[model samples]
Target: MEKFKTKIAIVSSLTAVMILAGTASAYAAVPAASKGQATEISAGAKADKKTASPEEQVYNLVTKLQPGEMIAYYIPDKKINLTDRILFSGKGYVLTDYDAYTAKAAQMNAPSLEIPETYPKDYKFKSGVLYLKEPDESSELYKKLDKQLRAEAAKGGKEFYTIPVEDGTGEASGAALTFVKGSVEISLYASHVKPPKPMEGTPVPFSNPDEKTETMVIGGIKCTYTTAPKLKSRLSWTDTSGSVNYSIFADNAKADVLRFAKAIIEPEAK
Candidate 1:
């Protein structure tokens, strides 16, 4: 079971990294008072009606967010393990059959984002992971999040937390489509929410010098393509509407990955 989970984690991480980079706006809707040990939570709260600082502006957006919205936030100087973080919540589904997989995705309450119905002939749909469900209180992940959040909160002052307090409350948060050809795994993540404007200290994604990045228009949709050492090459883009977002990752050539994204955004062209 551990081995199976490890494989799923490997497949899910690529998509997760992209999601974290893009779902900033969804964070605007989350409340600071919910979950974890941080009670002095007003990092984004109002400051006497003066102009909102970038962080405060970000904090204000959380109050207006609807339930089940696909959201992601940044918590600086985190000491907890990345594996322990509750990225999002809701029931999880892992299915291998293509028809069943797309069927399950269609039923999720996430924004009406597209799921590809086509892929390279040799690459078979291996599995689809919808959400990384919150760990149970008795689980090791839960214990780590609890201990770490408390430790961080103990330091005093407003705590921007790495471990989200809100989980399993809204509709399912996100979905991941995974395919396999021999030993290689490819992943696609899609959602309707757009990334929020950055807070004062928000870090940029793909900042490493070894990470090469570019933007190109595919089928009239602008996409960001990135290649990093020891990591899969990935292409990310929001739909022309700028509402729905997507990112596809593969070890294949950039042209092949572009073909995959084209298959998704322009299914007829495929």
Candidate 2:
């Protein structure tokens, strides 16, 4: 168990830890403003210094938002840099590109929101972005983007972008519904830095690290699984382009780990 404690320390060292969906990379990259795009989604939100902050804008989009009310997207607002504000759908999966910096500290108070069990009328997901009918008086920015995106959806192109979220009504032993916004579950890390490699041959007495590179078939997707399991905590990285690292803290992670994995990956299987 001492090794487990060390494992927790090792994986915990990584900063900007978050959830998916997984990894900050998954939440990175806001939607680029289409030059011709003529509307702003945050139109209803006051743009004054305090409210104009990215955190506020992102918060405005979900304040008191109930299930089936607000549609979620993976769009990243490219205008800001200090902290990237991402809109996570119900599954509460947020991703960030490797180079992107998420406003984790700023988003600490994001309101609880959910992914509707069903898409509202005339709404759809395309290429990882969610496209929904423009609510009356909706932000022009979103309207323009949605207009173009909806057109693209008509063409039948899609990605593993959007996923459905259930009301956090059910509780599972290994997995539980998460409504705590801006909280990182598994940050699909794509940063240039990595954890310090343990010296070879000497047993990492602390976490009893078991490192391996293998492929895992979760939710029918065959992706490589790189595990950095330390005794108390585990960090696993997989894939190269958009490499993913999961931060798991549990006495028993098997059931919860796979459950969370399926929740994020299966939605894209459609």
Candidate number with greatest TM-score: 1
Mind giving the per-residue lDDT tens digits that candidate 2 earns over 166-240? 222121101112222123232112222234444335553544246554666755656554455453333343323
For each candidate, what TM-score against the reference?
Answer: 0.52, 0.25
Give the candidate number with the greatest lDDT: 1
lDDT of 1 by residue, 206-256 (tens): 467898889887777778999998988889987666676678888866766
Give candidate 2's whole-model lDDT. 0.31
The parts of candidate 1 lying over 4 Å away from their true place are 1-91, 111-118, 132-167, 195-206, 268-270
